[model samples]
Target chain A: MASLHSAVLDLRRLELMANGDSTIHRLDARAKVLVTLVFIICVVSYTRYELAALFPFFIFPVVMVSLTGIPPLFIIGKLALLCPFVLAMGLFNPVFDREILVQLGTLGISGGWISFASILTRSILTVGTAFILVGTTGFTAVCRALERLGMPQVFAVQLLFLYRYIFVLTEESGRASRARELRSCGKKGLGIRSFGSMTGHLLLRTWQRAERVHMAMLARGFSGEFRTHHVSRFGWAEITFITVWSGLLIFMRIFNIPHLLGALLAGSIS
Target chain B: MSHHIVQVKGLRHIYPDGTIALQEVSFLIHHGESVAIIGANGAGKSTLLQHLNGYLTPTAGDINIGDFPLTRATLPDIRRTVGMVFQDPDDQLFMPTVFDDVAFGPLNLGLSGSILEQRVEECLSRVGAAHLRDKPPYHLSGGEKKRVAIATVLAMSPDILVMDEPTSGLDPHARRQLLALLKDFSHTKIFTSHDLDMVFELCERTIILHEGLVKADGPTREIFNNADLLAECCLEKPFSMQNCAACGRPKTGL
Candidate 1:
């Protein structure tokens, strides 16, 4: 009953976030998608040795999490796990070739510092953009956006099927895991053989469930197409939101504006 | 006499494994009539219903719905009109929300904007499930889910509604509510059930299937009165039939 209650709670939370009345949530998923794309491209086009310029790109993730009410920790946590690998690849520049590139006259910095900064920035930007896109829009809206933007009908339908059945399959997997645990309590406990058997049984159950679902869909007049009730409304606000975001990203990327400002402010203060 | 909305001729179905599910099963169902296809487990009743909507291609013979042949090409159109509701509402109402599930068929049919909303709303009301519009199918009670599943097809505005054991696993009140909703529908309706009382009450015509064949097809009254045929198909007479022994004529006005 607790599990059932939690399952229901998770579903309710997802539904609320997905169909919320917030302006960001209400914007056409396509618009959000376009904004995310533009933001990522701007971030990726930055010079690999540039670090200060990439700091401004943090605005994208911040705005996404704050405005859309998407959990920031989830996106940040996911990115934290992924970005380190790409960042580590760039870390080798400082180890083998630490040549002094620019002398601040009063301060000292090496060429490896700039390259390391660039690598870190690139990884952060790419991961941040991905996080913003998925965290705010969720998978269902993202699929609908893709479909509306002329994605192949087959792919779109496949996505919908995957989304619908994933929950069912996940539930079955959980049940199988629990059953295995219960049965093994008095025995040598579950091993690879039991795990394989559980997986096999789960697959068989899912297959039957899929067939039943297909038949059910046929009964309800489904003709190899996916449909939903929520229609995303594309408006001038959505257009303007993307336009403003894109312009800001382009401006920052085209002119190293963040670094220029940082230097000017540092010079003026000193 | 009403027009026979569904006409089947020598319908046969064999699984790829060569297990025969239906053998030369033929029947006629009139429009605005509730017909119950009753049988024991594995009696080809479910297989027969599947054929009606072209869910399973007939191994041989033909099934004609209103004039259109049930075939690969015609399956979509047949599905649009036939509206098959399955035994498990969980499988039927797979959408995240009741409104989405109900609106699914209409949306697929390309009805947009206000017209789509109107159709979905009307269907939900028809099934007396308007209050559950925003609720998820998984969150709903079994009975509520069943009604919502019925609403999903009802929203399509189909001509024929074929349900596989609609009353199965429902409590008596839920069953009665479902029966009432079925009785109110003007569409050609066929539901499979072993609930003899339900069959007697709502279905004017009854067909008993046994071992992949149509064993009996006649008026519900006649079918129920024939104790020998009922026992032969492994269905017992309803306990509510008190005057059946004294009355030689088929009972009327359930």
Candidate 2:
């Protein structure tokens, strides 16, 4: 019961995230995608041993959250939940063969730690960037961007159809599950037997819905390609904003500034 | 008389599972003519409409539109010439905004820049949907969505317009508005509708389909006057409309 309530709440939060009004949401989708991509690349390129140096990279995430009005807690919480998978894959490296590579003031960190840290960092940064992009740009805008970027029209139309009908299938599945639960009197609890039947019924419903949707498309003058008229223009502000973020990322990579800054500050303080 | 824009000869369509939706259907739609296909549910009305636009291939017959054969290679041309307005606006308007939905067809035909924008604007205005251009389709009222759906095909500038259940679920005012708009179009029209009153007022010809077969096809007045034929097709003559003083005198055949 508690889990269901939480799930509903999570869905609402995601809806809010997707529909939020902020500067990030207002930017052209191309600018947002490019910035997010650059941010991911910079985060991934950092050497694993430079843990303290990586702290400055948090600025990118923080700025994104504050400007986009996305809840910091929500982004961090989602990333934290995904951490276990990265940890599991990397944990095996330490257990299989232990090889100490570096000694930092009488404490030894092995070669496995480097790889583990890389995995963890990459996972957090990639997922965080993806979440921000989708939350800010919305599905339709992302699709439009992809279309403008010269993706095949057939594939674009297919994606649009998939997005349009996914909800119908989910609603059907929800009703079927409720019916099963009501009949089962809470004992069976949607086990494999009923689940199989529910899935099959959903597939049939989807098939029927697809036919209707295709007919509808044909009626609307859809021949082979899906076309839309949502125009996007990269204003001067959007261009500069994207340029600055990309330039910073590129500069950081070229000069190794994150590492040098941390080392300089540490040497002066100690 | 204008040349026949749509010529379907012995058209038959049997579903893969062997459910025959259309059998031996024959019809001719002349240019600038408005015809209605009417019957009760499961009457193969939609199946025949799909065949007109080359959406569904016939099992054992031919459909020719303005000298263009309904073959796989000629589908694009057929679609450009014959615009189809489906029953459900939700399925037809797949784009996020009304403007996008209306502009879909024109864009597919590779119309870009100011010309595409001009056509989209004109189409929206034609359907009286210009007010809702930027609004998302999911937020539209049913009538508004239907209008946008109509605009989407209108943007294609097809020579023949085929609509499926155009007035279904519309309020009387919206239905009247749609009927008026459709009446103004010079293109050939083939529509399936349950609104008998609208059909009688707007269509010069009516085709009655029953159980995947054409039961009656002729002048609208002649078909409406045949009470026994109407009863067999599960259709009732619009007595209220017939008796309405505003609609004026009854025609000779009815």
Candidate 3:
């Protein structure tokens, strides 16, 4: 219940940050979304055993954090929370293929270890980019941009509704959980059965709330589409942003900047 | 014009499970008249209000909003005429921000540019929520959210304002502010509430629903004065009508 309450607040904090009047936040959502897509593709397309090449990709999120003025610690906390999922996914990799693939002085690393590190790094970069995108551009604007970018109308609307209702749904469930926690004297009946029934009631209540919301929408002349009045055009700045960031991402993808830098440093030292 | 009038006759609604929520309900509210529908918990007040806006189809009855009958074809026009503010502000405000939620209806009506912005501004100011326009609905206090929800309905320029529980879940100050705002609206207003004091203060007409039927319908004072009738229906007079607690004498007019 406490986590649920914090989750609601965290979502609100991120959205509140998006309302800042900073330059990066003002850019059309489409530009940020397109650039983030390019960044994700570039980061994920790296080969399975390429660990050193992934270091350069961190620059994008770092730059975004500084420019957008979002608290780096908050984004970092979110990233850390997500790290375990990525870790669990790649945990078995080192056990499967132990053939030595790289040699750094005496410590020989196997293919599985290199690939596991690569997977973890890639996930961090990709997920970090997404978080930065949302931090700069609010979720509603992102949904609108996605709709304009050829995503199906229903899917875009569903995503927006999902984001909007998440707070309400979480708050309801949180209350339900707190109620159960308080009513279960001596911690009896605090197991899965009560949780299951509480969740079922929560689902039922959520369904009824959804129906009421749909009715409210209908009463407002909602024919189908959610019309927005504040129209933001992708202008010169957007074009420049997309072009420069995308070019940098592609360049990072094509060339191993980290490897080249390491070689140059070694040569200069010798 | 008849656009502001709401008329219902022989309205009956039986849920699919065979429990009748409303039975033989009828009322005709004139333009600019404020009416309060009051009843016990299972008295079908909400079920009746839902029928007014066409959210729930009556099993057997005819509802006429303005000149047209309540049917799928005329639903849009009826909705435009009768702006419904639901009980929970959360249900009414689904948009991300207060501005967007206030502008949702007008935007769906094809408003754009400065005109739309002006409309949103006007409604927000009407509810004294202009400062909270850019904030998301989830960030607002309960009273602010309720005001924004009212602003959303007001943006549509409805001829008749229908509220389920306008003053529910509000502190005394917020409830007073809402009552003042409702008093200033020069249009037909219909609402359902358990706040008997609010019902007595705002509505000139009061309808009592008991067992999904119209138990009594008349002037607010007369309806509240009939102690025997109110007792039969398991209701009581508004607090303002009761005697002074300390002095044990009748209170002055509300």
Best by TM-score: 3
Q: Which residue pairs show collisions in model 2?
A: A219-B84
Candidate 3 lDDT tens digits, A6-105: 8668867787677777878889999999999998888877788889988988898998989889999898788788888988999998999799998999
lDDT of 3 by residue, B19-114 (tens): 999989998999899999999898999999899889999899999988899999988888888999999988888765788789899988889999
DockQ for each model: 0.51, 0.30, 0.77
Off by over 4 Å in 2: A1-35, A45-54, A61-124, A131-168, A171-192, A215-244, A250-262, B1-4, B239-254
Q: Model 2, range B98-160, lDDT digits (tens) per residue? A: 776777778777888899999999999998989998777767888998898888888888888
Residue B115's lDDT in candidate 3? 95
Rank by lDDT, descending? 3, 1, 2
Best candidate (score: lDDT): 3
Order the numbered candidates by DockQ, best leading. Answer: 3, 1, 2
For candidate 1, lDDT tens digit of each residue in B193-235? 8778888888888888999888988989888888899888898
Candidate 1 TM-score for chain A: 0.73
Error of 1 at A11 (Å): 7.1
The better candidate by lDDT, 1 or 2, is: 1
lDDT of each: 0.79, 0.78, 0.88
